[model samples]
Target chain A: MADKVLMKGNEAIAEAAILAGCRHYFGYPITPQTEIAAYMAKRMPKIGGTFLQAESEVAAINMVYGVAGAGYRVITSSSSPGISLKSEGLSYMAGSDLPAVVVNVQGGGPGLGGIQPSQSDYFQATKGGGHGDYKMIVLAPASVQEMADLTIEGFDLADKYRMTTMILADGTMGQMMEPVELKADAVKTYEKPWAVTGTKMARKHNIINSLSLVPEELEQLNFARYERYKQIEETEARWEEFMMEDAEYCIVAFGIAARVSKNAIVAARAKGIKVGLIRPITLWPFPKKVLCDAADKCKAFISVELSMGQMIEDVELATRCKKPVVLCNRAGGMIPTPEQVLAKIEEVAGGIN
Target chain B: MEPKRVSLFAGHYGSGKTNIAVNYAFLLKKMGKEVTVADLDIVNPYFRTKDSEKELSEAGIPLISSAFANSNVDLPALPQELYSLVERQDRYAVLDIGGDDRGALALGRYVPFILEENNYEMFFVVNFYRPLTTTAEEAMEVMHEIEDACKMRFTAIINNSNIGNDTTARDVLATFEETEKLSRLSGLPVRMTTVTAQVAEDMKDVENILPMVLQEKYFDINI
Candidate 1:
C-alpha cells in the first residue's frame, strides 16, 4: 500500500533512517536540507534516538564515527561546503571500516556555492570523496522515494560490507515531494559481531582508529580494504534500464538528470528515435560490465550531467574510447528541460523535424 | 565495419541538447546497446558533457570526448581518434556540438566530408521561442545555414520547443505542427518530435505510435 504523504527528500531520509534502525544521527544545519535536521531534532529524542546538531560538518561526521565505533547504526547529512569539511572524517571512517551512512543533499560549489540542486559534486561523491585508497558506496536518488529507499539500502550495504556509504542527492531530490510507501517495520534491525566495544568477559579492547604509525601495517590494512572493495564491486553494483531493447543510442545519467533524460527518451521514441536510458543507482561499484556490453552494441552514448566535464573522464575510461560519447548538460541552478534533451538526442541519433 | 548511426546535436545555449544526448546514450547502454558520445563543444565553460562521465562510465558506457586529453583546460581541437570514429563507425556515435552557429561552423571542419559521405541525418533542433527562431521560416533559415556550413543536406527536423516545467502536451503538438510545416516546405522529413513525458502522461490524448527502439537506420525512417 502506498501512503500519499507529501514529504521532501530530506524529511523522508530522516524518517527512512529511523525506520531502518539508525538510532544515532549527528549533523549540522545546512541550507536546502535543514528540514532533515529539524525533523531529526523533533523525532530523535521522542524515539530514544541520539540526534545532535554538531558545531560543524566535521564534528557531525566525527560524531557519526564515534557512534558507529560503538557498534550502532548512525549517519550524518550535509550540503556541499559542509560535505567538504566532513571529507577528512569520511576518509577516517573508510580507513577504519566503519559502517555508517552519509547523505549529501548536493548544492552548487567548489567553495560556498549556492544552495541549489547541482550534480557538480558527481565526481567528488562518486570517486574517492576523501584522500586515500577508499571508496564510499555512492547511491544516487532521482526522487524522494529513492532518497528514502536508498538511505535504508545504504545502511544495510554499509553494514553488510563494513564500509561507509553515501546517498548522493541534489537539491532537487532533497527538496522535491512525492508519494512513497513506508517499508514494513520488521525490516530495520540487524546485529554485527565484528563491532568494537569495551573489553568484556573474554575479549580484548578493540582500537577503532585510522592511525597506522607503521608503514608496513598501513600497507597491509590498505591491501585488506582493497580486497574488500574488490568483493563489493563484484557484488554490489546496480542500475536501471528503460526501453533499451535493440536501442541504437543510450543516454547515461543518474539522480535527477536521469529522470529528465527518461522524458527525452520517451519523446524520442514517439518521433521514431530509438533511444533508451541507463541509470546508475550506485556510483561506486559502477556497473562497468553492463556499460561495456552496451558499448558493444549501441551506436552512440551520451552522458547528461550538471557539471563542466568531470564524469566525462570516467566514461572515456570505461568505454575505452571505442565510441563517441556526447555530453548534454546545464549548470548554475538551471535544470535541463526535456525539449533540450531531445535536441541533443536529435543531434546524436538522428535529426528531428 | 558496419557504419554506425551518427547524429550531430546542435541547438541554442541552454536548450538542453547536451542533456538529451547524454541520456540517449544511457538508455541505449541499459538496453544492452553499445554507444559512444562526443563532447565537441568548447565554447561553454560552465556546462558540457564532461559532467556525467563518472556516472556514465560507472554504467560501463564509453565516452569519446576531448576532456580526457586535456585536464584543467578547455578543448580547443578535436582529437584524431575521435575524427576516425566519426568517419567510420562500428558503434552508435552522437556528436554533441556547441550552441551557436559558430559552433556548427567549428564542427564543419571535422564532419563535413563524413556527413556528405555517410549521408548522415543532421537534425537542426529548434525551440520555437528561442530568440531568432520563433517561426518556422526562421527555423528553415537556420537549417540552411547549418547545411551550407556542414556541406551536407539537412535531412530532417526535431521539434524540441518547451517552456521548462510548464510545458504541456498542447504546446508540444502546436510546435510539432509548426515543425512539420517547416519540414514539408523544406522538403525534409520530420524525423522526430519531443514532448515532455509529464505532458504526455497528463493529456492522455496524444497517441505515440513509433516504437522506442533503435532499429531503423538512416534509410528506414518514414520521414
Candidate 2:
C-alpha cells in the first residue's frame, strides 16, 4: 500500500534521498530551501549519516564533491542564488563523472531578486547551471510527491551514468504540502566501489578528482559525459500529455507552474477551448521528441511561466520554430493564477479558431 | 534559513498579520531557533513572508514557500522539507497562512497530513483592539471562518491585542476574556496569553498563568 503522508517539497527530497541510499548531505541555509538542510540535520544523526551545514553554498557543493568522490550517494540543494554559487562544484562533478543529486527549488531571480516562485532558471538549469561543456540530468517535479519519487530516481540515474542529477523545482512546489508515501527503511546504505577512502586493501588507490591537465583528456571526459547524456535523452526524457488528442493548441510548462497549467487546461476544455497541456517532467533532456510530435499535431504552443519567456525558448527550439509560441508570465514573487493562464489559452485559441 | 518548525500564524487582513509573522520569525532566530517560514500566501502578493528572504536569511531564518519551487534552481520544496523533518524528528517549521478564510482553506490542504504525522499547534493571533475585539461573538466569527476554511480547530488562541505602547492589563484581560469565552464556545483552549512587559510584571493578582513569554520565533511551546 502506498502510504499517504502530507509533506513539503524539501522534506520529500530528503526522504527520497534516504530511500535512494544517499548517506551524505552537504548544504547551506538559503531561502526556499532551508527546510531540506534542517530536515537532514535532524534525521542524519539518528541514522548515523552525516549532514554538514557548510559555511556557504560554494563550500557546501565542494563538500558534496568530497563526499560523492568517496563513492557514496550525496546531495546538495539550494534556490536560484545559492545554485549559482554551487555551479563551480557542479561543473567539477560533471567533469569528474561523479554521481550526486542537486535540487534547485527556484525563486524569482536575476540577482537576489525575491524568494517568489519563478521558472526563469529554465535556461540556467538545462543549459548548465555551471560553466562547462556538460549537462546535468535535470528532472522537473510538478508536485510534492514527485519531489520524493524523482529524488530517488535522480540518485539511481546518477549512479547509472556516473552523472550528477538535479531536481529542478519552483517555490510553490517546494512550499506546498501534499500527501506522499515515504520510502521505507529510513537508513540507506550503499556500496561504492569507486570511493576514495584512503585506498583501502579492498580496492585500488583511487584518485577521484575533476582535474585533467591535458586538453585531449578533458575533451575525452566531456565526450564521455555527452554520450551518457545521449543515452538519457533516448531513454529518460519524460513528459505528460493531457488532452492533446485532437487539440488545436498546447500549453508547455514545467514544475508547479505546469500543475496549475494542467488545471487551466481542464478548465479551458470545459469551456470548449480545445486546449491541451504538455508537461515536461524531465527538463534537461527536454523531451524534445515528444514535443516535436506534439508540435506536428497542434496549431500553436503557449509557454506559461512565472518569468518572462525562458522555457519558451526551448519550446521554440524543440519545435524548430515551426509553430508560434506565445508567452504569458508573472515575476518577482508572483504566481500566474490559473485564470490568467486560461485567459491566455482563450486568446490563443481565438486566434487559431 | 533558521531552524524548521511546524507552525501556522493566522488572522484577518490588514491586521499587521504578515508583519507580525515576519517579525516573530525574526525574533525566533535571534533566540537561537532554527526556523523556516513558508509564505503560503497564494491570495496576496504584497505582504507575503518570502519578501524578506534576504533579511531573514541574513538573520539565519531560512524561508521557503511556493515561490521557491522550481526545477532550475536549488530551493528546497516545502513538502520535501516537511516530510524530512517528520522523518528526522525535532525541527521547527512555521507557515504564514493567508489573511482570510481563503488562507485558512489553503492551510486545510496540508493540515490532516502534517498534523497526523507530527503533532502541531496552530496559533490564532488576535488583536483585542481591532474591529472585532468589542465582543466575544465577533471573535468567534473569525474563529469560525478559520475552522470552516481549514477544517481543523485552532489549537490555541494567542491573545495579542494591544494599543501600541498605551495598552494596559485591563485591555489585555478584556481580550483574553473574549478569547476565553470563544474558546469555551468552540471547544478549543486559550493555550497562552501574551502581555506587554510592563503589564506582565504588574499583574501579580492572578499568578497561576499557564505559560506566556515574550513574542519571538524560537520560544518553547511546551513551556
Q: What fraction of native interface contacts is shared by candidate 2?
A: 0.00
User: Where in model 2 is the C-alpha error above 4 Å?
Assistant: A185-191, A201-203, B1-223
- Model 1 over residues B11-61: C-alpha lDDT tens digits? 654345666667667756766667787887655443457766776688776
| Retained true contacts (fraction), each candidate | 0.00, 0.00
lDDT of 2 at A70: 79
Candidate 1's displacement at residue B40, Å, is: 45
Which regions of candidate 1 are displaced past 4 Å? A1-4, A185-189, A351-353, B1-223
Residue-level lDDT of model 1, residues A1-353, one tens digit each, is 01233355787899889888888889998766776786787679979998898888988999988889888999899988888999999999998889999988877777776766688887888787689888989999887778888888988898888888999898777755544555745355557665777678678668888999999999999999889989988899999988888788888888888888888888899999889988889888787877888888788888988776566666667777777888988876556777888899999976422
Error of 2 at B96 (Å): 8.7
Q: How well is candidate 1 docked (DockQ)?
A: 0.01
TM per candidate comes to: 0.61, 0.64
- Tens-place lDDT per residue, model 2, B1-223, is 2222566778653334555566667656767777677776655433356556777788777776664433333342344454443343455667777756766776766776676765666777666554333356666777788778888767766666555334567756656567777678767766555555577776667543322323232100110
**What's the lDDT for candidate 2?**
0.73
Kindly report the TM-score of the first chain in candidate 2: 0.95
